[model samples]
Target: MSKPRKGILIILSFFAIYVIWGSTYLMNKIVVTEVAPFLLAAIRFLSAGTLIMVIAKILKFSLKITKAQFINCVIAGFLFLFYGNGIFVWALKYVDSGFAALIVATQPLFVIILMRILQGKKIQSKSLMGVGLGLVGMYLLISQDTLVLSEESSIGIAVIFSCVLGISFASIFVSRANLPSHFFVTTGYQMLTAGTLLLIGSLVLDETWTSPLEWSGKAQLAMILLIVFGSIVAFTAFNFLLKEVSTEKVATSAYVNPVIALLLGWYVLNETISVQSLIAGAVLLTGVYFINSKKKIVIFSRFKKN
Candidate 1:
């Protein structure tokens, strides 16, 4: 690809991950209200994956993958979509969307820590400062009277934290994993793999599955957005960026998603935005900035292909 074209793709991908993904908190929160978490996730991923596969085939992108590549895709699917997203959505039952986003904002911290541990990469001074600030922000967010007063809220927060760690690890793994060269193909397979697992989970848990025709109009619309924009567009951008840039650079989306989720939650859902929450978000985003400040949008000359 040409330099200008690559730059445009990078910017567009960032916008998808940063802005589009932020809105998904509200989408998932809305859908999960009436749908069981695993069921909801399964539907979204299955639909999106099928759509992506159809599009890829029409565009003549090869769908074939070796056994090792398929296995890696399944692993990525499990870590990222099944546990990271499905469990996170389950937490939404007990936690507010905006608050959940704020809590998950600690993802960049997790990513950097994993890099240091797994790769023995030295942490920069700025990143160390970022980690300190992120911890402070996290403490403030979780120590709120609302969270402390409710046992369910505490469990939800802990679950979301675990999801963030899994997602963080997935980000690092995707950077090195061999998969289909085309982002669409890779994303489709992973989504399908995760969707299948989530379906089985939903059945195993005996979660009631409602048909789409019976869903409310608003829920239907939210599901559509979640399937198309959230799952397809934003997730494809996420996969693309993991290969194109540094994981820390891609993790910068954490800095923006909470702010967007907060505003949308406050405006649309009328979710309370506590003053402490605002302060925490500010501190957390600043920490993210410090962690990612030195990282640039450096695209790899050749994407890793199976």
Candidate 2:
């Protein structure tokens, strides 16, 4: 590919991740209004996973996996989707999507600790500072007053926090494990596994299924957008960008997601965003940047002369 073409593709791929993934919080908020969280999550993953498999087959990519691979994928799916995603959806009923995204944004802080705990990696002082900042951000975002609103709300915050930790561990595990060379294929299997497990969970929880015919236009649109853009296109783009660009650049999505989710939540749903949430979001984003970055940003360093 020409340099210009490559750059354009890279920009578009980043756009997909930043915008699509960010929009998904709002999408989840919309879908969960009528559909049960587990059922919605189950269907989303099952469909997206199937779509990816089909696309891979059409492209003549290998889709076959060993029995052990399937089992590993199942475990990853359970962590990444069934708990990380499914529980987040359920929590949205109590917490605002933007608030949930803010909590989810603290994922890198957990990842830093997980890496140290699991692999015996050394945590740097800056990384420790980042973790501290992230904790304060969470406290501010979920102010004591907010937590005292109801027991359900407190549980929701806790569940979302757990999901962040769950996904952090899942990512570390997937990286260490021997999986398929095809990233999408691995993602497909993980989604399928999570989808299947969550489907069972839906039945176990006695969640009612609302027919497609009965879904509101907004709900239907949210599902379609989430399946097509959020799961397939954006995720594929993210995996692609990991290969093409510096991981530091790709990690910028961590900061961008909350802003997009917050704006969309406020604009479309008119969800109220508190000043504390904004301040906390800023702190949380700074912490994530510190966690991902190897060097101090020294803010506005781009303007410095070489």
Candidate 3:
């Protein structure tokens, strides 16, 4: 593809990812009240994964992968989807989706720390500053809410943070793992494995699914949107962008996602956003800017050498 065409594709992919993922918070907030969170996530991913895999087969895409690649996908699926997103969906039961998204936005900081520990990568000064800023932002965001921190919300928050950490660790493995030649094949396998695990977990943990079918139709529509646009389309666009653009650019979705979630929560859900949350959002954005700036510098230096 030509440079201009590739650039446009990357931009469109990024836009789709940001918009769709941002809306997922609102969708989750709607759905959590009716559908069980883990069960809902399991169904969404399982259906989407099956659809993608079938489409790939119809298109004559190769599903034959190396044993090592299969194992890698399973491991990443366990970490990223089963643990990461699983915890996220569960947390929605206790916390506001907007608040949950703010916490997840700390993912970049976790990724940096994980990279340093696992890869022995040196932390750039700017990234260190970003971490400090992110920590302060987190404090501001959480302090205004109830300081008592009961058992349920505390556990929910801890689980969500663990999910971010798991995703960070899984990403490092993903960078090094042998992958299938076709992106769709790889994503299909990962989603299938992860969704299956989530389904099993949900069945084991959750009691009888008692949510009535007569609830608000709007909530049901939101769940459908979560499955169709948020999980399927957004993820496909994210994978496409990962292939076409620098990872740093693709990572900017973290910043865009929270802003969209915050706005949507206010507009659609009528969730209150305080001045402190606004300040924290600014700080978080600055932290992401610094983190990505360092990555861009490295990319530019490599390009100049080439």
Candidate 4:
């Protein structure tokens, strides 16, 4: 690809992951109101995963995987999709989407700690400062006097933190794991396996599986957006960036997403953003910037989409 075309594609991919992925918090919040969370997640992933597989085949990409690769994909899928995404959606029933997004933005902070524990990585001074600010930001965000911390809301907050941890671990795992070389193939397998497991989990929990035909028009539209743009488009762009740009540059999405989510949630859903939340967000994002300041992007050979 020429430099000009590559630059344009990079900008577009960043938009997909930044704006589109950010909007998903609001979309999922809307859909989860009527659809059971696990069921909704299963449907979204299953549909996106299937569509991705068909697209990969049509593009003549090999779909074959080794046994070890398949197992790794399953583990990744479980960590990333089933536990990380699925439970996060479930938490939407109790938490505002904007609030959840703010908390989830602390993922980089979690990643640093997890890397230290699991990989025996040393904490840099900059990272330690980031962690400190992140903790203070979190305390301010969650301990708002204006906010009512109901038991359900407290549980939702806890669950969202766990999801962040799961996603953080998955990121580290994927960086080192052996998997399909093609992003499309790897994503398809991960989503498919995760979606299947989510389905089984939903059934086991005896959640009412409502048909789309019975859902509100708004809910249906939200679900469609979640499946297509959120899961397929944004995620594909993310993987694409991982190969094309530095991960630190891609990590900028962490700062952008919460801002987008907060604005959209407030504008569309009338979700209140307290002054404390805003202050916390500023502090939190600053910490994330600090943590990412010195990292380099690990780029790979660029691949063609078609």
lDDT per model, in order? 0.84, 0.74, 0.72, 0.78
Error of 3 at 159 (Å): 3.7
lDDT of 1: 0.84
lDDT of 1 at 1: 85
Per-residue lDDT over 172-272 for candidate 4, one digit per residue giving the tens place of the 0 to 100 score:
67766788988778889989999999999999989999999999999999999999999998887876676675333455566667667877988898889
C-alpha root-mean-square deviation, candidate 2: 5.8
Clashes of each: 0, 0, 0, 1
Top candidate, metric TM-score: 1
Flag regions of model 3 displaced more than 4 Å.
91-103, 152-158, 210-216, 240-255, 294-296, 299-306
RMSD of each: 3.5, 5.8, 3.8, 4.8
Select the stronger candidate by lDDT from 3 and 4: 4
- Give the per-residue lDDT digits (tens) of candidate 1, residues 32-139: 789998999999999999999999999999999999999999999999999998888778778876477567767877887898798766667776777678767766
Q: List runs of model 1 lying over 4 Å from the truth.
A: 91-103, 135-145, 149-160, 270-282, 295-306
Query: Per-residue lDDT for 1-306 in model 3, tens only?
Result: 798987797667777877889888778777777777678778778888898899899999999988999998899788877888886776766665546656776776676666567655565677667666766766676567654434577777888888877776665566556789776787788889989998898999864464537658987788778767886778777666555543434555666676678778888868899998899778867865775573544431211110
Per-candidate TM-score against the hidden true structure: 0.86, 0.78, 0.81, 0.79
Looking at candidate 1, the ten consecutive residues that score lowest on lDDT are 296-305
Q: For model 4, give the 10-residue run with minimal summed lDDT.
A: 297-306
lDDT of 2 by residue, 149-204 (tens): 34477788888888888877776666556566687888788888889999999999
lDDT of 1 at 234: 96
